[model samples]
Target: MLPGTLRAALAALVPLVALAVVPPAAAAPAPEPVAPSAAPVAPAAPVTWTMQPSSAEGPDGRVSLRHVLDPGASVADHVTVANLGEAPATFLVHVGDGTVSPAGDFDVLPVDEGPRDGGAWVTLGDVEGAERLGPGSLRVSVPAASAVTVPLTIAVPADARPGDHPAGVVAELVDAGPSRVRFAARVGVRVHLRVAGEVTARLVADDVRARWQPSWNPFSPGTVRVTYALVNSGDVRLGARGTVSASGPFGAGATHRDADRREVLPGGSAQEVVDLPAWPLLRTGVRVHVAPTVVGEDAVDARLEATAVEVTAWTPPWSQLALLALVAALLVAVRALRRRAARRVQARIDAAVVAATTPPARPAPPASSPPAPRPSSPPAAPRPDVVPRVTEP
Candidate 1:
């Protein structure tokens, strides 16, 4: 099963819906319906309703209920219901307190739950009887193709809170089925009632925050996500409208994003998020605003209030830093290459300088062979030959 609030919101958007209230001077006797209710067990009869502001009370066919009254005051109005079926059909007329749904929609209290606040002050009666009827509810039966008008009286209590208090008066078809499961249709109109007083309107900003998403490319810009909450602290509801802005250093790259308008209930807040393109600067300024638009109140008399919040952020200059690092690395590499080349050139030059400046090494003298001992040997051979000759002589 859906939650109670969700169910009530869905009910408020039902197709069988209309709203209107008759002016004070328009009060008059509504025409007789001339209808009656049939047995409860009879076949389910198809029915439709046509509601309008009674001509005797005000204009013809006004579709919404609206009024502005001071405390301890009251007003008279009328709502007409038409039955299109061929048989008599019964309806239970009731009213409920109104509220703004989370989705920024108008809704009323559930049919099963009775009014607890200002809605309880309203009373109803049958036009023909001219007597106070049920508490937040009344029963009426209309014949086929005929209509009935019910008078509405809203009395403001002496202690009623000032501001807009929306309510609804509905005509619900009574289900008379045998099973526990019952189906019924209801048609109604919204009541825009304001308890007159000194009304104050205020909107506030809270928890303003921003997140940066850096782009992969160093030269390209990145994105900033700005988020904030708008609070309605006044006694009435309001619509929030404004913009979020982010700027880089020196305000060079600025981005403005429009906020989505949403209804905020009294004492309630709505969170808004916006994505903005931002530059790769070191510092950033982020601002969020809540500009209140008076809603469900008398705009002519009510004042519009606004609030804004600003925050400072630091964005890292990774791209620039990376570039500087690369340049430093290249300089280091070039210096190393130059030093290596200089060393090689210096080695070759040193060799050539020595060759041109220094003398060649001198060659050492060769060793002499032993002197010949031939003189003594030749002398002995000659003496032997000479000795032989002398002996013979």
Candidate 2:
């Protein structure tokens, strides 16, 4: 036998060890993540159980579990649990409200958190407490290789909101050893409950934002990361559909991407991110349209019941735009420089041409031309008269 101190220390480490192996959640976690596969069981554990929707032929062959009920309405259902181990085993049964993880995986309320939604509406014939399974959780024993059918009832309150309320009925295996480790291997089926009357399937896009990551090469394409929150403003669980479109001003270079499909619970919200390869145009108008879709059997009238919400975001490709502006400025500066240089060159050419085409100033005429032979003829006549007088003298 182990010493008292050793036993105490082992007991203290039990919960921590259990938590270390299990996936983390917002609340108290199970020893392992509940597997959704048909034969979900704890790894390396001897015990195995199968939980499936009730069936007339057998519980193993049912397709899915769902119910559409009016306010204050109640429905009877059965869940089949089987023990596939070699020896007899005891299992705990739990029913809890459902939620979706940030990673878009479906989950149930933690063991510490009681059900406030459809999980609270579930009642088991063998279980004492209806909500969170505690000390009052029902335990059932089955012989080796044997299966038992457990009957359960779900009631929708008169004031139950119309739409989808997801829940789960889990069959868990607990360790009863001295260490008291809280290891539970769970297997169960989903419960999709819809409270009838005016099921509003609507989603709203909120806080839509876009960020552009420009490529270093201004001529190449960049990335556009768009993010938005899908809020289930109506009273049902839904998946979002539609497209996110980005277009430059005046509808140039329009680009669009499809939104991924993810479940959102009624009154709950989820964030979606989409990355698109795009050319970095100067101004881009971003628009997101999310239409709500009702999944499961409750969606008979979904076509007419669904509604859509839209949001818009405008972003400027500053990096690419700045680069373009810089190029334009450089081009203008170069053009101005070329023009100035051409004007200087042309002025020099014009001066050279004029000098070559101009005539030199004529040599100045003799500053005073000799007085022309003023009276050559008159001198001759005078000479004739003067000669006659000299002869007479």
Candidate 3:
């Protein structure tokens, strides 16, 4: 009923009033501002490092430090430590005595044990603040992705023994701080220093012992077990390969077994055992032959010789013997039984023949005709007497 312009204005006002009353549909909670999704976090990296024999020119591709000198000689060398981690690392550089492990691998003594022999003669040069660590070792800091080279010296005493003195330079990583559990990593390069003097190479076999294990099967042969020790009695390291052989008297049923090659250090020995299949000869003779050779990459000026030792073992064939005895006993029993049966049969046949050949005894003649005649005379008298009585009846 109002004008069109006023009505249009009123209609627009009505919509505004309705929106205000409804509170603009609660503004949809502002969509929580969508909180911008967070980016993923990455894991931290591990620390690592390496140590190698190096020179001023940087890692010269040398695996170890080898030197041959006189009794009072001295030598100089360098080792580089590389920090391949994201932070700076400190390392301990020291010299240690080297020895051959039971597994034949070259190893160094523990750092805390220090060193003797050739290791005692070697010294590591000082680094920044090295006075805190003493004379034989050095502590140096290497920056991340960088390397530090340390110098070392080996001064042999005039009274040093004349032979090979094994030692090595070791680099150990220092922990960042005190912790409930500590882990330390170390690496080293071997130092093979030979003092000028006589170098002898000798390898021998000792404590040669053998045992024959007989098989239970009578038709199969048995095995011989040979055990011996390989001794390095000389001043140099030696590697050896050997053979174990067994034979009966006069070289009968000879068999041989090969032993694996092994390395032994000076004054060291290794025990070896081998089994060789052989025939069971009442007595078996076993011999061990070991051939010695030089070990290590270094050239040695010495003579290597082969050595041997012998032993004997008793390998009796008890099964075969028992079988033979059983057979013989059975055979004797059977023979005795056969003989007894033959004797019994012969006696029976003799009795049967005697019974068939011997004539039956003739019936004994009536021993007495007298007995019969007495009866007949009695009867005739009775009859004559009775005849007169019968006539009256």
Candidate 4:
């Protein structure tokens, strides 16, 4: 609600009502202004609004009319709240995404959810988070008379379809203190998002290299590593029912090569080089089957070429330059990652040592430690007169 308009509105109501009640005198001639026989007309009644705080402002509090949302646009409002009450009348509320409620709580829509799901379902405690927002929902409580500007925002995941969808922002007034207030007003936010029709993916591996590590080493032989890595590079995150199967050189064997696997997601992938029982690497000409996460997605018919794979010893003459280059790169990468891990572990150890060696803090002084009572000498002499005579008797 906006200001200044209310004052002008009250002013305009008077003239309009006066003109309606007083009509032009009928053609009857005035007969010496005789005493009126009818009762006087009463003024019009005042207009009553529910939460008529002395002041309120927020672009008049209305949603946008457009039906399109941008890639990462916020579906929130910049609300400016001020104290209109003589004392202080604060505006406190919480905001959330989903279907709007008549009483004003919010819930999520299925389409807004991610392929991977899990986030907090929250009822705002104090309206502090409102100072910041963008992720999920927000709840706010304001102090009276003092003005606060809160920006309400909405988020659209990049994967959302480009078409129109139904979504809204719901905000509610909550009890800020122990005033025992009953009900609070609510505000609604409308949003339309326009998501682009594109998703992106790339081969994340660097220059490919392969070599043979000692048999006891946990890693796959270099030849197997590079080949498997590329095949796994495409996508790893996919619907549960997806499948990726291959036969040819690589690790595919007579019975094993036919092993079926789940499909990967658009841009997620993983890789591995495993041990083989015989020289029968899944060679070229072997067939592969791919079932996409979605029925119509491009991954449904993934027919990849299976190239021949062979391992060589890492020692000088047997180890080819190609294999040596790969080994060198792997060694550098391993060293870097190990250093990073070592630093993290050392920091954690330092923290633990400091915690163990530090002494506990002493407590505050006791309030009742006071002056001690001293033993005093007994009365030196008894009452002289009566006491002495009684003793003798």
Top-TM-score structure, candidate number = 3
Error of 4 at 275 (Å): 73
Deviating ranges (above 4 Å) for candidate 1: 1-59, 83-92, 126-134, 138-146, 171-187, 213-221, 260-265, 280-282, 295-297, 300-302, 313-393
**lDDT (CA) per prediction:** 0.77, 0.75, 0.81, 0.39
Weakest lDDT window of 10 consecutive positions for candidate 2: 127-136
Candidate 3's displacement at residue 103, Å, is 2.4
> Model 2 Cα displacement at 95 (Å)?
0.5
| lDDT per residue as tens, model 4, 1-393 | 548999889888999999999998779776696776888777433221112111125445343323334554434335444444334333333333333232223343332242122112122222343532334444344444455444544455555544323344344444444667665455544333233443322223222243323332223222222224323333222322211222334433322232222433233343433332222232312222332233222232233333333332122222344567788999999999999999999999999999999999999897987799999988777556755335554
- Give one digit per residue, the lDDT tens place, for model 3 in 1-393: 899999999988998888778844444454445677789866444557777888865788988888888889898887888889888777887788887775667878877887877789888876554433755677878789988777788898898766678888877888776576767588888888878787888888999999888887778888888888888888776788888999999999999988855577677788888998878889999989999876668566788889888889999998778778889999999999999999999999999999999999988777654545444444534555455545564
lDDT of 1 at 104: 68
Q: Rank the candidates by lDDT, best first.
A: 3, 1, 2, 4
TM-scores, one per candidate:
0.59, 0.63, 0.65, 0.24
- Candidate 1: residue 42 lDDT (0-100): 60
| Higher-lDDT candidate of 2 and 3 | 3
Top candidate on lDDT is: 3
Say which prediction, candidate 1 or candidate 2, comes out ahead on lDDT. Answer: 1
Pairs clashing within candidate 3:
none
Instruction: Judge candidate 1 at residue 289 and give its lDDT.
Output: 72
